[model samples]
Target chain A: MILINGQPENRIPVSDRGLQYGDGLFETLAFRNGELELLEQHIMRLQRGCKRINLSFQHVDSLRAELAMLCAQTAEDSVIKIILTRGSGGRGYKAPLENEAIRIISSHSMPEYPEANQSGVTVRLCEQRLGLNPTLAGLKHLNRLEQVLARSEWDDRTISEGLMLNINENLIEGTMSNLFIVKNQQLLTPALTQAGIAGIMRSKVMEIADSMSIACHEKALTVNDLLDADEVFLTNSIIKLWPVKTLLHNDTNTHWQHGALTQQIQNALKDLAH
Target chain B: MILINGQPENRIPVSDRGLQYGDGLFETLAFRNGELELLEQHIMRLQRGCKRINLSFQHVDSLRAELAMLCAQTAEDSVIKIILTRGSGGRGYKAPLENEAIRIISSHSMPEYPEANQSGVTVRLCEQRLGLNPTLAGLKHLNRLEQVLARSEWDDRTISEGLMLNINENLIEGTMSNLFIVKNQQLLTPALTQAGIAGIMRSKVMEIADSMSIACHEKALTVNDLLDADEVFLTNSIIKLWPVKTLLHNDTNTHWQHGALTQQIQNALKDLAH
Candidate 1:
């Protein structure tokens, strides 16, 4: 079901900034048993995006309530998406002085993924590079053409995700999820100060690591850093966590045994969601 | 009138990848006397964008024919806009294997611009720096949050436009148009190899300069270069050209007495549109 600003509709004005200029932010969270997971973090990120882009987000509290009402109607597992655009604007690029942001809230049944995805998944390195933009580095703004292009690079059912790196050859993230690797008993993820979205699941994993007294680090990781790691995994609000069993890069392959740390983090993440 | 895939409608599916991920390209051209100005150039740029993003543009001829028909319906002055999106896809970043691009064509009355704009206009330097992405550079794709943000930086009725620079501190272009400056009888515009759109009007300006025996150069320009120029101007498909009479940067100001070269080029461009 799709609700465009609390009204059931499947159409948005053609002049919407979301369509005109990709001027918007979006959140995709998992909803199960009448509860939305990590909704607070998502809302916080959305508000942060609005602040960064100079858009007003004063109605966030009321928006949360509307989302809750929508989730209350669903009893099974589902994925909920929220798209907040700068609304319709004039033909020029200048934003309207008096603006009403458009909020598109929708829900869909979760896709059935193979159990193999949980055990482990294979990933390929993408040729497309993430542009360096510190201003838009972490927020989940709607200018996601880079991600869409990276994800389009591979379609093998056996290859679950594509790993993307910034133009400087530093590891950034997966096309759809954040990445973390285990090296010398320390968890390391690429710093998103230049590009890539800082996923909510990534933050939760770090939080869980902190509570469990495990070491987690966010640094400028390189391809060699990833290849030398003992274990690798991906995270997103929807997928939760997926241990990467093999990574194919530069026509060569590297394999991992899926270390104990990945399992521990996975179990912790699952526990927190419930 | 607004037409989505040949049907009159002002709404598009909310699930459209254009609105969701900005996986699309758009063109805005002026229509007067039953003909689209620079229609061929617009189509070429759109086709080039499709190729750069791995999209198919085999239907270009048909799309052009439809646009011509739409333009014919308007005997008076109007503005025509064509939007081509990668159609709706599943909830992931991965594009659908079999793609069906969506085309939205629309027309509106010409906006009334002050007669002073034709003579010359003032501009301000925007604090929002455009992200450097060579992969997506020069293509008029839909991921325009940077432009939107830059344009939002100012709203003074006196300032006709805002100048934007790339991450490297090099003057890229105006928020809504390509930029050019006349220094020592030579026209210089920023090289779009790193960032900025290769606007159709920019190409026409260069063409006009060539036929008029004027030297036009595309280089990596700096603020110092702009400040030292004898004349400055901006170009886009819609506005054609607007001479920059004054530029405000770093609390200081640089003024130019709209040079004769600007008028010559502007007159040449106007003649070509006929």
Candidate 2:
């Protein structure tokens, strides 16, 4: 089901800047049982994204109300996506002075992944490098061609996710999730000061680690660092946590056993999800 | 007027990847005196963009026919925009296996600019820097939030355009056009190998300069190079060529006269337009 601006509709004007220039922001939340997971965090990220791009989005309260109404009507585990755009405009890159924001909220059935994926999944390194822009980094804005292109690099159903590096060859993130590596019982994730989405689940995991008295740091990582890690994992809203059992790069496979730290983090994340 | 998939409609499904992830490409062409300016060149660029992004777009011939029909029915000067998207998809980054492309073609009235702009216009240096990614550079794809953000840096009516640089501080292009500078009777434009759009008019100007026995080269440029140049100009299809009379940077105004080389190129472009 879809609600465009609180109305039951599935179509938007072609002139919308979201469709024209990808000038918008979006948030995807998991709806499990009768509750929406991390709804506040998702809304906060969306609000920050709007501010970063200077989009005049003033539909927060109404959007939340709509999401709640939609979730109440949905009984199964689902995915909720919210999109806010600068609305329709005439032909030009210059945004209209007085513009109203467009809000699109939709629900979808939860993806059914193999139960084994939670225990371990194989991943690959993508050839498509992300562009480094500090101004737009860490914001889940609508400009996602880099991720789309990276995700298109492979079709092997066995490989679950593709990790992406920036043009400078520094590991940034996975196509649809955040990357984390454990070394010497310490947790480290790539610093998204240049590229990559600051995933909602990524932050929650870090917070969980902190509450558990685990040391977690954000730093610039590389393929070699990932290969040498004691353990590896990926996180996103839908896929709460997937331990990377194997990394396929240049016809070479680097393997890692789902270590104790990864297991502990997964258990903590699972507790938070419920 | 608008035609979506050869039908008269202006709305697209909310599930379109174009709106979701900007998984698309577009071209903007000028229509003048019952003719589409550089229609073939625009189509060629669109095709190249489709190939670069690996989008399966097989509507080139039919798109041309539709453009011809639309142009034939309209009798006034206007602007034409063509957008090709990966169409609608389920909630995810992975593209649909058998994706059908969506084509949207629309026409708008010609923008009314001041006659004085042709002589020369003022420009400003934008604080927003573009990201460096050679894979996605030079193609006029739908992922243009960087450009949109750069354009939003200022709202000064007197400033005709804002120039942007990459994260490394190399001058790339204007918000909506390509940049060229002249020094010692030689023409130089920034190479779009890393960033910036490869504008059609920029190519035409370089070709005309080559035929006219003028020296033109593509190289990495800097703001100092632009400030020291004897002549500087911006180019795009709609605004054929706008010589820069003044550059506003950090409250310091560097001025230039509309030099002979810029005039020659402008005259050549005018001839081609008619």
Pick by TM-score: which candidate is best? Answer: 2
Pairs of residues at least 3 apart in sequence or in different chains that clash in candidate 2: none
- Off by more than 4 A, model 2: none
- Residue clash pairs of candidate 1: none
lDDT of 1 at B122: 91
TM-score of each: 0.97, 0.98
- Candidate DockQ scores, in order: 0.91, 0.90
Residues A1-274 of candidate 2 have per-residue lDDT tens digits of: 8998889899999989999999999988999867888888988888888888887777789898899888888889999999999998733778876676788999998888889999899999999999988989999888899998888888988999999999989999999999999999889999999999999999998998999888999999998899889999999998899999999988889999988999999998874443
lDDT of 1 by residue, B1-274 (tens): 8878777789999999999999999998988656688888888888889988877667776787778677767778899999999988754788887775688898988988799999889999999998889899999999999999888887788888898888889999999899999988989999998789999999999988999889999999999999989999999987899999889888888899778999998888884453
Question: What tens digits encode model 2's per-residue C-alpha lDDT throughout B22-71?
Answer: 99999988988677888888888888888888888787888988888778
Q: State interface RMSD in Å for all models.
A: 0.6, 0.7
lDDT of each model, Cα atoms only?
Answer: 0.88, 0.90
Candidate 2 chain A weakest ten by summed lDDT? A265-274
Question: What is the overall TM-score of model 1 with all chains considered together?
Answer: 0.97
